[model samples]
Target: MTKPSLQILAVTLCFALPAGAASLSDPFATEAVTPPRPSPQAAGRSAGVPCAREIPAAPLTAIDAVDLTLCNNPQTREIWAAARYQAAQVGVAQAAWLPNLDGRLGSSRLWSEQRNYNSTSAALTLSWLVFDSGARSASGESARQLLAAAVATQDATVQSLFLSALQSFYTAQAARAAVASTTEAERAAREGFSAAESRYEVGIATPADRLLAQTALSQATLNRIRVEGEARNALGALASVMGFRAGQPIELAAPPAGQPDAAFAQDVAALIAEAEARRPDLKAAEAQVRAAEAGVDLARAQGRPTITVSAAPTWAEVDRVSANGGVVGVTVNLPLFTGFDTTYRVRAAEAQVDLRAAQRDSLRNQVALDVWRAYQSLTTATQSLRTTLDLVASAEQSERVALGRYKAGVGNVLDLLTAQSALAAARLQRIQAALDWYVFRATLAQAVGALDYSLLEPAAQGRP
Candidate 1:
């Protein structure tokens, strides 16, 4: 109720309320937005944005599969949370530039032989660091660089998941194609069996020929069954990767049907250079090096001098007598000695810088090698596509001719069965080659840090 008490109460209500409100409101809270991409080209690929999303009941395309996996998979969420945590650290670093305030209140009672009295006191203190030899700046820079690293790491993780979804989708498609090939082989074998039975009934084919045709039909049927099972297993694996139960059913649209683009034959050296420049993992490593450099600066600054300003106001009411006072001062601190702790800290921070630099260089080399390997794989897959196309065509023709010859009684059943088997094998090879082409194309894009929805366009090589 006194003047000093009123003043202390006013300051407490004024400054303390805002600080309390800030604590409750969370000024550093991040929005539930999509993780930032390393490049603008990836913006169109709307994956990894956590929201209420449902997988389409209809068949999924390659792009759909990737989007679902990124949105639903835990890997993306974990990396995103890490980046957000780093963002909060940036806020913490920025806070070092601001002033701090504290308030204290105390009450005590005394009882003696001849006197009894109650005492009450209140005080408010404010401190602001005016200079710290650039320590705050160095700390803020380190935190910001770490945040950059975290963001780039998130982009790298998203690209990895994108490639994984593509690989699984393509594998499932290949398995389905294999099943179709086996079914066709089974049909061809059945036709051959029918022809053999007809020939044996008319005394034009031996019992051995009839027996061989029946055996070939049964083998084809068995292969068809096995391929169907494989296709189912492949679908289950894909479902699991998409954050669904392993047994969940997922229908996939017919894959793109064309061979990979010839433009992928670009110079390998140029591609490697592009990857080093654009790869998110490389960027992340480079950021870590810069952060380590900032850490060295922070360590050195910690051993320097600091200048701070402080203010305190006090109020007291004891034995019905009130008093008020205020104090303001500036202080300087010089770290003259710390048992050689600063010396070791500076050395450790400098060593960390060296370690980060070496790691960054190592990662840069790995990026180049990754691009080279992916390029070579895609090239090999492309060449195999041509051979597989020719192989399937020739095998189909041979099987037809052999079947015609056997039906006309000019060839043994052995020739017909062998040709049919060759055609079946050729079909499987073609399917596998197509799958490899799709996978390698995506792999090359991922290696170059450009995996996105554009790669899955209808006109791109993703079809088939």
Candidate 2:
């Protein structure tokens, strides 16, 4: 009989619970089934690299790789995350337009020698804001502008990070080429030394000549090893930037092998103009100024009036006794002197507007400076590439002449070794110049606000 009575009471209580709360089961009664966490090794990525979901068909060259494929890159994901967070901001601002709703419900039964009673009650109330001197509207607009700025900031960061990754990858490639060139030169020198030693043993070449060949070979070999180590470090740096797995392959697609296009505009003036109009960084900053202005309006509106309506209903039962009642009305809150606080706030808000405007103006000048500096780097890189190309061409010709002379027995071994070293240096300088041009152009692109990444390219093969 007691168990049946308890069951009856439980059923009554479940039916009388609030609409939303009725569905809320006893959380403590349910055993939580948690998903297995990923292994630590599998979860950590490089400090800043994005995870690329799919490896590309071919190796991705610096200029051809995706900006930030987050499969392996966390930084890329971080930039994109701002847009997602802004969604919450939208919800917060829009909340003002919706009516606030609240509710309560309860049920109980009791029987005693002196009394027997059962009671049930439920209430739903809604409150809506009627006026606030446009404060709500201003606040909503400010939130909207801030959301836009966040999106813009994310875009700008994405562009900058991807461009940086691309450049770092290119630098590593050039370093690899430099190491290869020096290694080959060392091998050639060692072979020449072997030949000279053989000739000296046969009394056909002087001991001085053999010694000179040995010295050159030793120096070349040492240089090769050092440069190869440098290349390895460069690869490591690039791997760090990619945020890929330690042993993961990072193939690069070959970039277009043409020289940079002809100079678009002469100097910093044109570049500054372009940045002011197009740069995402500056655009985001300007948005802050607008948001701040709205903030000032909001603070001033606090000195005015606000209208709201509130309603509440409640019920109580004890020993089978019960009572239920509710109240509903509108409220108008008026501002009065409270230590001249509102007056001070108004003054502060006006000063903040002035500060924001000044900051905006200052940033405009700073942006111009950035554009000018990047533009200058691009110009210098162009000139350097031209000079390095000429140097490489001359070294190639000289290496050919030395090789021919050595074969014909007219040139001393020292001349051949010297020419070989010069050719190696020239080749490395040319590659470095090309890499500089590539990176600096990307920088200039970012500064001038033209940094749209084409997601079409995939990472190429053979990079690990």
Candidate 3:
């Protein structure tokens, strides 16, 4: 009857809020979230330093190499994009807290006996989940925690690529050093052969001496050739990691001409604690555990009662006659039974929380072990550097004395060659020790989550 219709119209008009009442800000926007930080070198260039995408004309330094790798590497872009995806999920969860408004329109024509009529209707409905236990809050919290995990994962990936860049750069430098050492050995061998030839021509040296010196020269030449190839291979590897073609030329700046310092000497227990606190991967695992916990709350809330308020206003026209009416209602939904879906969901969410906690604990132990191994390796490398320096010095003196005695006809060619061989081996060991020390230092810094621009500073003055 008209009375009931009029009552419905009155309630609709009372609840039909103005569209202008809605919040102005977009609920789905993610601009508030911060992205991962770019490389410090590239950021520094914004102040005054010139930055170019192309390879620099000058030789590349370790810092420059890391910057290029971070800027051009596909992994960096992939990780940050994933973080942005998680950020979007956060926005989606946030949007759930706001009300929803829907509009509908319909037109229909009816024919009966000898009569036809058309009716058109339009309606606007507004629904607000005034209460849903704590489902909305729990979902939002879970989304935020997952976003934090994503950002932390991004940081961990960046650190990994940084360490890889350092490793490749150091390897290239070591290879070049090997080439230089071999070249010097070849020159020494040639000088010895010339000395032996001169002595033999003057009837002061045996034929065997001349032949031995020639054989030594050949071996030195072969070593130089082999190391030259290795140097090129190392450079190619460095270039590849920097997002360049493998065969591309990449000249590296000379390595620091000094022994590594003991600046890394610290208590292992303290270092492990620092790593546990600072490591981004570990932080990410913690966030995952928190997010899983939030999921459990959300699942439990889903099974509880939900209260929603809805209002709809309608306008209709039939046979040139108009009518205005609407209905306003509140819906309370309580899941009495759903084939035990909610029960299983809550159980699954709880299990997920436990799983994540276990994973986090496992990663914590691995982090401690990583710090310990890196610390020990660095310590061993440092000691080796000092010992190799002394070995090279003694071998050099022995070679000089043997060569001098042989040239003066007071020593045999065998002694001279032996001393020179020892010097060559010692030089190689010295190069290896330096490479190990630098690499292990970077590894330790990575394990501690402290690898950054400060570690890329030029070498200090000291013996290598």
Candidate 4:
């Protein structure tokens, strides 16, 4: 081949190869590439909190547990990632407003009989849709609304995780209190059994009385065992919610004194109103409705005419002769028919709008129900707290009297056992009431979108 022909072929070959191809090889050759694994440091960073080698020495409060859960839980990170993805979608929507530029390169070698011909061309094209009947604007608006909804949903997820951690903390505390109460009962039973054996040895009590006292002691021991198991289970649950491994040892501090009456002073009506205005899930639903409405506009615009401007500058080499040219045009495209595809799309978009509207209304009703239920629960727990305290006081006095009577040969073993059991039950009831009060208080705050770390803090009691 002549020098000019050779130079033309070399230039064409340079542009013809794929951008990332290796030198002196076909551009489209297949090669398997292994995906890279994350380094140890990167993996650790993404794995959240590291597992503890030893038990936590300090007592954890509800606030501390919530903070740990937010920092270490995978669910919280998943929500954050989703929000970031929506942000990227917003950027993509914005890019639709700008023009697009694309580059193209081509080469071909043809042979017929005994002669060879070569051609190569390169072009730079710019295309801008100058008018689209507001389709791009509607799409951008829809994406922005969806992004807002994603952010609201992420906030709701955080609130949910914190509530779970708080409830688990309260449950663990209640279980521990039950174990203590049961231990006290067991001690009381052991003393009663010893008294019954002494009385029988002196011929003052029958063998049956000793047997009854032994049975009571056995029952108390069994109850203590059961309660201790429950306490361990509760601790495991707390650890799981706090983003720790199962069976990890964790000590919990006593819950702060809470003011149930003061917290419940706000009426259900006001709470419902607050929930409607502040609840993140409800806000997300409203945003979804707006997004669906924008989608309807976009679907309608899709069937209309679009006006676009296009231009291209071209260079070509044929038979070693270089040539250049340019082309410009304005085009209008109208969809005449698409087998009813556009018609169905618009209908689908309209139905989605209706669906979103229904969802928003449904969420509003649910928020109101949540507030009402939480308010009622708080009131019932508050009342039970007072009643349980009275019951405990009475049960304690009764146990003391029965034990003294038995010691003086006036009361039977059955009376002492009954009194002891009642005292234990009363104490457990008091613990349960307190736990319920705290749980309902937190639930009400969550319903009103006011649940935060502050709710777990120590506050002045409205009643002692």
Q: Give the candidate number with the greatest lDDT.
A: 3
1 or 4: which has the higher lDDT? 1
lDDT of 3 by residue, 164-279 (tens): 88999999999999999999999999989998999999999999999999999999999999999999999888888787888877888977654567565568999999999999
| Stretches > 4 Å off in candidate 3 | 1-29, 41-51, 108-113, 196-211, 458-464
Deviation in Å, model 1, residue 399 alpha carbon: 0.9
Cα lDDT tens digits, model 4, 1-464, are 23443354455446544566534332322221111121112222233444443446799877667766766677866776777667667656756765666779999997889888899998777677889999999998998898789878877877788779878989999999999999999999999999899899999999999999999999999999999999999999888877778798798987665434544455678788988999999999999999999999999899999999876777899878888876789999989988898899999999999999999999999999998998898888888998997899999999999999999999899999999999999999999998898788888888888776556444523211
List per-prediction Cα lDDT, in the order shown.
0.83, 0.67, 0.84, 0.79
Total clashes, candidate 1?
A: 5
lDDT of 3 at 277: 95
Q: Give lDDT for model 2.
A: 0.67
Instruction: Indicate the residue-level lDDT of 435 in model 4.
Output: 87
Where in model 4 is the C-alpha error above 4 Å? Answer: 1-56, 257-263, 460-464
Q: What is candidate 4's TM-score against the reference?
A: 0.85
**lDDT tens digits by residue: candidate 1, 83-195:** 87888787777677767788899999988999999999988787778899999999989988898899899888888888889999999999999998999999999999999
Cα lDDT of model 2 by residue, 1-464, tens digit: 13443354355445433343212442211112111111111222223344345545567655334433323467655655655556456556655754566666767776789987787666656566778888888887787777667766765766666666767777878787787788888887887788678778877779998999899899888998999788777766666666654435656555455665535457578778878998777777788888888888888888888898765555556555566656678989888765788788878877877887788789888888877887787788788888987898898899778867766677777788788889888888888887777677777777777754422122211000
C-alpha-based local distance difference test score of model 3 = 0.84
Rank ordering of all candidates by lDDT, starting from the highest: 3, 1, 4, 2
